[model samples]
Target: MGAWSKVRRVFTRDANIVTAEDLLSLAREDRLGGRTVHVTNDSALRHSAVWAALRLRADLVSMMPIDVYRQVQGLQVEVPKPPVLISPGGSEVGIKEWMYSTQFDLDRAGNCFGIITERTGVIGPDGRGLPGRIDLVELGEVTVRAKGPQISKYKICGVDYDPWDVWHERQYTVAGFPLGLSPVAYAAWSIEESLNAQQFARDWFGAGIVPSGTLKNTSKTIDRKNAREAKESFRAAVSNGDVFVHGADWEYKPIQAVAQQAQFVEARQFGMGDIARFFGVPGDLIDAAVSGSSVTYANISQRNLQFLIMHLGPAVGRREDAFSRKLLSNPRYVKLNTDALLRMDPQTRAATIAAQINSRTLTPSEARALEDRPPFTEDQYAEFDRLFGSRSVPTPPPTAPTGATS
Candidate 1:
């Protein structure tokens, strides 16, 4: 017990390891009734100790610099006469900085000292043993005529409130962050955080349970390549389970793996759905299924329909400019074109798909090439005809224009 007490005393007595120091300024009122005052203080060394307080106010105090030892009337001025306020608020035409003021007064002859108090709180190993202390200091003041509040009120560059107001800014306390770091400048941050959060929930948590205010599931979320790959993996895993099991002698381990992978994929779907919804896209149309081709099919199907209705529908009908706006308003066209083009040339299809993502105009050849591909469905064509007014079927390649001047 005695040894422990000695160890504690050694740490406690180490003045260098723990000491308090703060700067303060004091200014005296004018003796002749119009001189400026400047104040300074040293936080640590006691009144009896040999040390002067540090001066905080700037050197170029006013428009011109005055030496502290200089005097205006020769009253044996220790501090300079006409002391310009280093603190910004004083008699300045314009002010933009936080200023601190200490209580001050001057006698018939201008003489001053700034009074200030401070507290120190530190914690470490001997936790409770370490205690905080309050310190008081008196600093010499300067005689000055200008008043900060009278000249300009307490003004600061960025902060508009009182310096003390900073204390009430909700803090985490543990992490020491303003709990509401949510600044007006970052208005879009909430949307982005919402976007990321919904995605994380979908990717990590299971599917079908999507976060609120996200894009709708009816829009595409999964990429063609990714959707294809995940679908293939899911299918293979499911097939492997079937092969591994014989009538009634089911191997539980592989079955569980298959089920787990499916669940994982489902979670990804939910995540995608969450993302889609956050962006104001429909979540229902995304192919969040286990079938390799079908997953691709679902994502593609939704995008394609949107594309057809948007860009292609307008572009084919001679609304090229509107077509772009339509596409921009809905990105589902990208994957939609990919799904449709897969039936033609996969390489060109990928290129065209990439083009759509960048919002670049498709070349004439690019657009016409898609026309050569067989229609996705006879029923789809009929539906299109019903909606867009059926056109007379075109004659074979060499047909002549009947109304042309031959």
Candidate 2:
């Protein structure tokens, strides 16, 4: 059995799983700037860096088109016009929106939920249901209702759905837990640290660029009413507008403190980097400072390749497997075409395509398709042959070195 299967079995059979009451308590513990870190999708996304990272990843995955293929005699054949492929939900938004929503939820909450509907009168001979329509459910609205280790049912949008009817995609989960652990929840301290820093900066500026200090009235016998008036006047003059002048020893001594003194900027940047790590996005990708690599990157395609392999590969693989298991049967698989992200400069791409065409790994028509161009017509083929025809030439034998052999 696979590792996931083992984990599932252990989780389903474990007796020490948290009860419904505990799960509710854990799930509900979220507040902004509170002692306990709240890591809900809405609250966590308030940070711009986190939102941007999630958006980038979701769009990157969802923008890719999904291809469905069937196995016939041990060969995979592309399935065109499959009901599930065309429209998974029988809605106007189609697959891209569905994928975007699902990926967003998966990235933010570490879980995604979908409802599956089988096609009517389209069942195959093997008694397997034909996939008809699938719909994505908001991750925030779904609640896991479990009895011991096993999940009893899923409550979504005030309706109860059987475990079989709901398709669940989850990320990291601890032992005996039916729900996946969100990155925000796991890294709440880091995210909250960032949020606190942001709030501090806002308050600092809101209090004006002037630091906190005492305002002394050197005038003899100042009344309480006069002191209050002077305080409000000073605040209005300093915070509301620009320059202000005070008469007679009524001076405002400002506290000398800077953000750099406390490394506030550095802390905020570090927090952003931490969030990026949780999302599997490179710090440099989201404009966060890349500490080690300060050199300029000349090869964008190479960087994109590394990102695809190192960062996005696992998430995309999980999505593919989920589609394969739930929407397709054995021997058939689903794939998200990532060639678009691998595109290079025109000249470089042309050279690469030429190499592939020469090696028979890609045809001219296929290369054209990659460029979103039409396939070659017979006339174009004739022209190509005329320009570059097959030919064989005889080579002269090597000559002896001049005046060498005696």
User: Which lDDT values do the candidates have, in the order given?
Assistant: 0.28, 0.71
Which runs of model 1 end up more than 4 angstroms from their true locations? Answer: 1-268, 278-406
In angstroms, give how far residue 405 of model 1 lies from its true place.
19
Tell me the lDDT of candidate 2: 0.71
What TM-score number comes out for model 2?
Answer: 0.73
lDDT of 1 by residue, 1-406 (tens): 3422332333244331211111111011123542112222221111111111111111111112212232346543334222112222234311112111111111001112221112123222323211122111122221111122121111222223322211111111112211211111111222223333444444335443212211112334667786676445544554333322223422222222333334543454444444333222233333322334332334454554563463234322222222122211222111112233224355656776556534545443455465675433578658768887983233234657898775
lDDT (Cα, 0-100) at 271 in candidate 2: 88
Judged by whole-model lDDT over C-alpha atoms, candidate 1 comes out at: 0.28
Residue 329 miss distance in model 1 (angstroms): 23
**Any runs in candidate 2 off by more than 4 Å, and if so which?**
1-39, 116-131, 207-211, 215-252, 256-262, 295-298, 372-406
**Total clashing pairs in model 1:** 35
